[model samples]
Target: MLRMNINNLIKIFFLLVILSIEIGQSLIPLDRYSTSSILIDKKLFFFGGETVHNLKPSTTLDQILYLDVSKPFNTVNPPFEELPNTIPFGSSYAIAFPSSQKNVIYLFGGITVNVNTDLDDFKSILHSYNLETNQWTIPTTSGIAPGRRREISGVINNNTGKFYAFGGLSDQFTGTPNNTIALNDMNIFDINTLAWSKGSTINAPLPRADYTATLLSNGIIVFIGGRETNAFRDVDINQLALYDTKVDKWSLMTARGVTMENRFLHSAVLTPDERIIIFGGRKVPNDDPVLNQLAVLNTKMTPYEWSIPQVPAIDNMPLTTSAHSATLVGNYMFINFGQITPITNPQIQLPFFYILDIRNFTWIIQFEPEKSTIDTTSVNKSPSNSTSNSPDLPVEKSDNGKQIGIILGTVGLSIGIGIVVGFLGYKYYKKQKYKHAIPTAGSPTI
Candidate 1:
């Protein structure tokens, strides 16, 4: 009987250990900034960013991390898998895009930090990683590559197999603020021929960095929200810069509707119906994360209007974040690791990843395949009908919060029960052993 009780206690202890591991896995382990991410097939790959939180000349990460979007995942616990092979060099603020060919991801132009030293080196070469074989290679290329720069904005044209890179900071802290050069030139990379060529820079926007370059269905790349000249100044937020890939020309237009302040280091996703959803970034002058974290730009509308979609307040809704990666998978946009506060601010908090369902503008904590569908009625209408304030949308409750709560409760209960059982079993065993022990020769019998 005693042996059986001991075995049962051991079993309970092991169960407790396993449960603790499961709980640990639910917490996010990644802390990164300025990372570039791309969605290829069903997997989303993240590469090259600073990992450490408060270090100057921040630590650059070389490991490639990926999450399978096809599988069910949640903000509480993202199933991010790391590839065994690392990139050729550690980098941050690089541009990553998929090649027209299968299983190929291209990385271009990021700065590398030597953790042991103060030297920060700028990378100018193009590197390719093969997903199938898990290999990284620097392919030989022809034509002049863009001058070494980081915080560059780039988008790949699937139709022509070309990548358009524009506007990046050439140097950082080389001397005074004026020494840091912001570039306005456009560089084109051909995936098929492994060559680089200069794109037309006539009427290009002024030198900028940390901006977003989104490719439209019509082959026009839209440039938005970045710092100009140096990191201190912001480009005019009113001017909508458009680059026509077909004509190799650049033009500026204006957006109407709700006015938006200057922002940089934000993430933008082009929805299926041609709407650009802009999320979290630092604003100008003070470099604080924008309080209004979500905005929508309807590209299909004439003269392009920006609207603030009213997001229902939820317990697990993401906090303000910048330098994050937002990947549009299906109708849901998955936002990954980013700092909640500005790097300069001492109170830095990194929020867990979150998802936004674009169909009806719902914030989802978990990925539910059944719920992922296009609500045609919601997509056709303007996101915000009123200009006075953000348009209020209907609040739809999600079961994900309850599900997470139940899971945590169950785990907690199991752990508590295991502890009690183990403790009781231990005490009972001690009492039994004492009762059964042979009395010492000198001891008096009761």
Candidate 2:
């Protein structure tokens, strides 16, 4: 009977372990990378991008995906809702920026792959989407649109209702790095006039591609690291270029805090507090993207400064990557899919995403597929090290405290129960030995 009790307890303990795993997995969402995203109201809308199965490329998705992130969400419970109307063609590396009109966003210039040759075709037309009507439309512009390209970045001035487009690549639609020329031209589109006019390129940054351009509160555009040429040595490292719209002037900014090296294809988003947060990009095409640190540029200060925040080595943190998109929605920054590892297969799929609580500097993986080997999210409140000049920022608040507590609690309880069961089993074994050794019916001992 005692042995049977021990077996039963062991089974119960196993059952508990399984339950804990299931509960933890249910909270992780599936991953999708290389998509364009925009936040309207509290909903995040994802447009055409690539999805992968193993290392093989799946079909490029054209359907619009929407997720209501106003509350804590289980990514797979209902999955992301897809709109019935699909974009004319599936695309990737497109620009999706919000317009002055609420619930409206402009989608411009992306590349569609030629399925047969696996080459990319740059798009020249401009498209717009309305969140309320669930509609997509091709808008008319007076002047000619910019040349066909992808991996281009843009920003909109909400106060002025004008849109600005900066540097991007021109040709090489074959997906080959050779024969590509980066542009340094700037274009302006007046939303009210619906006319496109070329801005002065007299003092613009060097011709570059795969760089991040962020519009600050003071109307200055901050252009961070990117490659001026395909050659790794030609890539701009630890450099910053600032463009002032008011004066139509471009000048190099000498940032004094964290010293970051050259990175391209990284994503940057303006925080609510007038700070620009830059995350994951590649040092060079051949090298893996930086995976461990995030650079914060405070635009509110004169002679802008940067602070490098260290990400804790936790299971749930998303892989540091380049070519990803980071969208700011309230206090949360939603990081969408991009290349996670060094491009083993240029067609590789990275389906995971992460969320940074900017207020507290905590990181969490918003979604990871079941087939994924990524770990659960973890938060480190303190910076690994700080420079004497870095600002004393508020500690970011962590929302996963309860979840972390529960996971730790469950594991602890299971361990404790296992130890108690083992002790009882040991005692039972000793009692049985004593009984067996005792003489019964005057039997002689051997």
Candidate 3:
């Protein structure tokens, strides 16, 4: 009987262990947008962002979440690990880029939200995180820093060891009647010396933010469409602002291609062949038609040309994604969390990160393309006719919610079984003790 009881307890313990593993595997990070992420040595580290929960106010997240891209992982069950925070700091619209030196990532300006007051406080401080040490530090530096700002477009020239920060939504005029100012001034940061310096504002484009700044191989930075100083206007899509870093001069070039609508809050990634692929973004008005097509800009040509690629329609493809981080890893571009719909509707959580194989422009859910079918085709400049209506509700029900329900149910069942087994074991031990007990000099015996 004793051996049988021990066996039963052991079996139950193993069952609980297996259930716990399942719960852990199903767990994923919260839904977030405007998050900054950096890809270092095949590991993608996600920084501060605003998290959205059903029926609750959005919350700024301080936690650091990361995914190992070197290994093959399922999209539904992404193996994301959380790095412990040494100091708590959270913000949205921040930019994170890896240093030329290995194992270091630098986070620049962003806006911190005061949930209690529902106000935004812009930040201009610099924070550095060491992947090797797993430590975060605010490094002191000499020279003047840029004004408090968010949604700033920045890019690092690894050869020069400098980070170039351009136009952003500044809070310099916060107390003044203007209250909002778009900055076109350039700020330079020396990664090696930990110092800041202002760059030239000569012939800069109209003050803008929520744009993309891509660094070319020939020491030139290309600025794309963005929200201009006038909050309601977007920078013209036909003009490409080129900043020649070698001489610190700015010039505007006209791009030849199909007439494209103005866009902001979009993501752009440079291809090996000098093509800038522009992904999802929104127009000035949030309710306007969504920019669901991918725009490719060929920069190597004497005159820059734009083309809207025809991508095969795939189910569950994000029709609208803005304020998202897109990082290119080899042939695949990994798009992180972002708002899929207008801000007026409830934010829906995405179960998986979207992956695009730039080689053939195929949308994939898994990291490894071999596990899924790949329909390859040559580049076609044909326009996309696919149009998506602004979804009144979430596009798809989140699998995370169902997973949470399963975990909760399993926990409840586990606790109930534990309690019953514990009670039976106790009763059995008490009966055995009584049956084995010897009567001494008791006055009354039952």
lDDT of each: 0.75, 0.66, 0.73
Name the better of 1 and 2 by lDDT.
Answer: 1
Regions of candidate 2 where Cα sits further than 4 Å from its true position: 1-31, 52-59, 74-79, 100-102, 113-123, 172-178, 230-234, 345-350, 365-446
**Given candidate 3, what's the lDDT at residue 299?**
90
Q: Candidate 2, residues 1-446: lDDT per residue as tens digits?
A: 53455566567777755654344333222244557888776567888765443122424556577765654554224234556676656666778877667787888776665433445542545788887786777777898677776667888887887788887776664756557677888878877777887877777777877778889877888888777753233355446787887778788867777667677778888887889898887666475657444788887777778787766767666666666678876666777666665655343343456778787777854532222222233323676664677777776657587457556766666686776566555545544443343332221000
Clashing pairs in 3: none
Candidates in order, TM-scores: namely 0.74, 0.68, 0.75
Tell me the alpha-carbon RMSD of every candidate. Answer: 18.2, 19.9, 19.5
Residue ranges of candidate 3 with Cα displaced over 4 Å: 1-23, 54-58, 113-124, 173-178, 346-352, 369-446
> What would the per-residue lDDT of candidate 1 be over residues 40-132, giving only the tens digit for each residue?
866788886775532334367666778767667667667666676876567778889887669988888877665446365535457788999
By TM-score, highest first, what's the ranking?
3, 1, 2
Backbone Cα, N, C clashes tallied per candidate:
0, 11, 0
In terms of lDDT, model 3 sits at: 0.73
